[model samples]
Target: MAKRVLILSSSPRRGGNSDRLCDEFLRGAAEAGHQVEKIFLRDCTIHYCTGCGLCSREGRPCPQQDDAARIIEKMVCADVIVMASPVYFYTMSAQMKTLIDRSCARYYTEISGKEFYLLLTAAEPDRQLMLRTVDTFQGFFDCLEEAHLRRSILCPGVWNVGEIEGHAALQEACEAGRNC
Candidate 1:
C-alpha cells in the first residue's frame, strides 16, 4: 500500500546535514512507492506557541496564521510524518520545536491518527539525547488510538553542511525510506 508521507525539515540552515538526511529519508520512502512531500521550515514563517489554549476553546488554531498552518493541514492528512532537524542545546532546533508547538490543533481536535518518525543530526555525538527526543514524540502520539512510531534515525556529529553525504547512516536512512 502506498502511504502519504510528509517530511518536515525543521532546520533553518539550508543544505545542512539535517536537510540532507531528510532528503535521504524522502528518497528512500519514495522509492518504496510512498507519496512524499517535504516542507522546509527555513522557507516558511512559523511562529512559536503562546500557550493561549485558543485551540482548545474556540479552535482558533495558531495565531500566527503563517505557512505553518498549511503544513499542518498536510500533516493532518498524512499517514506518516518525518520530522527532520538538528539538535540544538540537547533538544530539537527552535524551528522544529516551534512547529511542534504550533501543532496543538491536531491534539485538541484528535482529528487525525498518524505515525511519526524523527530524523535528527547533532554535534554532540550522543545517542541518548536522540532517544530521549524520540521518547518525547512517543508521548505526543500516545493520544492516537492507532498511532505507532515508525523509526528515529539519529546521526550525531554531523555539524557541517553536506557533511552527511557519504555517511553510512545516510544510506541507511535512504534505504529505510525505500522500504517504508
Candidate 2:
C-alpha cells in the first residue's frame, strides 16, 4: 500500500553523511510509490522549546511562531517518519533534539501510530556507540501510542562530508525505504 513518508534530516551541513542517507531513502520511497517529503533542519527556523507548559495547560498554541508547528503537523500526518541525524558525541544532533522537543504541543494526540526509522552516522566505528541515540529515540516513541520503530541504519566511522558516498549503508537505507 502507498504511504505518506516524512523525513527529517537534522544534519547541520548540507550533503552530510546523514543527509545523503536521507536522500537515498527518499529516492527509494518515491520509487516504491510512496508520497515522500524531506525536511532539512538546516533550512528550517525551529526555535528551542522553552518548556512553558502553555501547550499542556491550556491547549494553547506554542508561543514561538516558527516553522516547528508546521513540521510537527507534517509529522502528525505521515504514516512513516524517518529521523536522520549525524551523531554528535554519541547522541543525536541538537537540532533533531530540539525538533522533537517542540512536538510537545501535540505529542499526546497528533503523534501516533506511525512507523519510525532512525538513520544515524558518527565518527566512531562501533555500532554500540549508537545505543544511547537509539534509546533517546525510543524515549520519544514511548510517549506515542501505537508508534512502532520499524528500522534503523547506523552508519558509523564517517565524519567528513561526502565520506558516505559509495558506502553500502546508502544502499541499505534505500532498501529500507523501498520496503517500507
Candidate 3:
C-alpha cells in the first residue's frame, strides 16, 4: 500500500544540510511510489504559538490565523512524517520548534499512530552530543500515542553551507525513505 509522506524542512537557510537531506528522502520516497510532500517551513508564515485556551474548549477555534492549521492538517493525515532541522544551540531550529508547539492544537486528538523520521545537522562533532538534540524530537513522540520513531539521521560537524554534500548521511536518509 502506498503511504502519504510529509517532509517538514525547518532550516531557515535554504539548501542547508538538513534541507538537502529532506530532498534526498523525498526523492527516495517518491521513487518508491509514495505520495510525498516537502514543506519548507521558512517559506511558510508560521507564527509562534500563543498560549491560548481556545483549542481546549469544545467548539472553540484558535484565533491566530496562520499556516499552522493547514500544516497540522497535513501532519494528521500523513502516514509518515519526516522532520528535518539544522541544529543551532544544540537543538532543533526555531521553525521546527514553532511547528511542534503549534501542534498542541491537535496533539491530543489526531497526532497519533504515525511513523517519524528525525533528521538533524549540527556543527558539533560528537554523535552522542547530537543525540541530545534528537532527544528533543523524541520527546514529542513520547507524548503521542502509538507514535513510532522509525528512523533518524544525524549529520554532525556540518556547519558550513554545502558541508554535507557527498556525505553518507544523505544516502542513509534516502535508504531510510526507500525502505519506509
Pick by lDDT: which candidate is best? 2
Q: Candidate 1 residues 51-81, lDDT tens each? A: 8887867867556768877877888888888
lDDT of 3 at 48: 81
Error of 2 at 111 (Å): 0.6
What is the alpha-carbon lDDT of model 1 when measured against the actual structure?
0.79
Candidate 3: give the clashing pairs.
none
lDDT, each prediction: 0.79, 0.92, 0.90
Winner on TM-score (1 vs 3): 3
Residue 55 local lDDT, model 3: 78
Question: Lowest-scoring 10 consecutive residues by lDDT in candidate 2?
Answer: 105-114
* lDDT of each residue in 1-180, candidate 3, tens digit only: 789999999999889899999999999999999999999999999888787767766546667789999999999999999999988888889999999888887744688899999999998788888988888988888888899999889999899889999999999999988988
1-180 per-residue lDDT for model 2 (tens digits) = 999999999999988999999999999999999999999998999999999999998889898999999999999999999999988876789999999999997855678899999999988888897888888888888988898999989898898999989889999999999999
Better of 1 and 2 by TM-score: 2
lDDT of 3 at 7: 97
lDDT measured at residue 38 in model 1 versus the true structure, 0 to 100: 91
- Where model 2 places Cα greater than 4 Å from the true spot, the runs are none
Is candidate 1 or 3 superior in lDDT?
Answer: 3
RMSD of each: 2.0, 0.9, 1.1
Error of 3 at 109 (Å): 2.9
